[model samples]
Target: MANFGRVIELTIDDMIFKMGTYAIEGTIPFDNDPIPNESEIKIWNLSPETIDRIKRGSIVAINAGYRGDVGLILHGFVSKVLTKWDGTDKITTVYVLDTDDISKRKVTDIAYAEGTLASYILRDMAAQLGLPVEQFELNQDFKYEDGYTANGEVTKIISDVAADCGTSAYVNKGKLYIRNLRYGADDVFMLSSGTGLIGSPEPFEDEDFKGFNLKSQLQYRITTASVIDLNCRRFNGRVHVRKGSHKFSATGDFMTEVEAILP
Candidate 1:
């Protein structure tokens, strides 16, 4: 698709606080691991009253894409808000954490009976933490042979349980997801020169996996654990996104970067 007319919509506490791309700038990252994602957004020139209304723990959601197409990019809670003057232009920076409440909550002495499914345990934990379930699928339904006891932070407990089941758990847009490591979301995004694939996909290798790092015109649909069908000069196939980020700036830098691996 042809990329044009950048758009950004930032909503705080269920109110549309800012819209348009020219004055909004920052990075929003998504991950496939078992931790919450954090985003930092800086808006230029906001009234003092508006900035004051944004408090810690307030709900925030950001939507960004081209004018004709837009999607929810980040939905989370505000962790901090800071304002300052930059050469007479006041800038308000908002720091947000995805699923902030669930990550910090502790599960104490929660016990499950033997022969309990991991999914059941996960759902129970989600209820205890007050997190909504977006998607939950395990390659194998692991049953606790000797039952199980959950403790510590909810994220950690979910991570440990997922590890035992040979899967990964993560929260996206305020919901929980548990799936196999080699797989991703069901919807696949086709990326090519005609569809906003910037330059060529670069080959990369790390200790755990080998994959490609790709850049495209700020794709709001692509997130961590998303499937992308990459079609370029050097490579053509489907890869699962391990991690990626969407970045927009007033300086004309608007792009999506993803590090994906073969599944």
Candidate 2:
């Protein structure tokens, strides 16, 4: 079991925000189910040097975990920034989007002719956008029937590709994981009872009768992706993490709310 404590660190470009120096409260979200994952961090008491150094398009890194075992949970580019004054203090909120979001900004100038395999089209598009093809695992057997037209946004093109093949494409960590809608054992992480698991895992029914029931929910202090093993009753074997949110506050409350599906 790991020690009980909070780990929160943020860096923009090369300027690192030391703990107890600038940030006060923030939240970083992680998900790989379908949509692109993004994070919003609200920080208080930012110095002029820090504010001036950070701007839109700056690379940002957010790390959080228990004491001594902190990991880089989110590393992406800043999409937007907002600063406001609450009469007593200045609060700055930074919005960050993963590499997948950057792909959305690119549009394909060439079209995929019919008989072109989906994997080929995806590879071509990804290459043009500077995303390494090796980072993604695509279904080579899937082919385009009607072919695609030019001037299509890379984001939309990829979404259509995934939907046609009944798969999903999302950036997990720093790589693009494109695969069928099946959660394999390779996606497993440990959430021991006393290590990071906050309390008992609570079982619940899905509000909407669509997809698998996200039957289990728990909280932890670690921030990372992958299926989590819940050491508890009602949730045995591997459970898929459907959604998770990381909350980090300089005041010492740092945790992640995890929603998972029963195997």
Report lDDT per candidate.
Answer: 0.84, 0.62
lDDT score, residue 203, model 1? Answer: 95
lDDT tens digits, residue span 97-137, model 1: 98775667887898889888888888787777677777777
Q: What is the lDDT of residue 248 in candidate 1?
A: 89
- Find the 10 residues in a row with the least total lDDT in model 2: 209-218
For candidate 1, what's the RMSD? 2.1
Residue-level lDDT tens digits of model 2 in 232-260: 54455666665667676766556677666
Point out the worst 10-residue segment of candidate 1 by lDDT: 14-23
Candidate 1 versus the native: TM-score?
Answer: 0.91
Give per-candidate clash totals: 1, 0
Candidate number with greatest lDDT: 1
Superposed model 2: Cα runs more than 4 Å off: 1-3, 33-36, 100-109, 133-135, 138-140, 181-187, 200-225
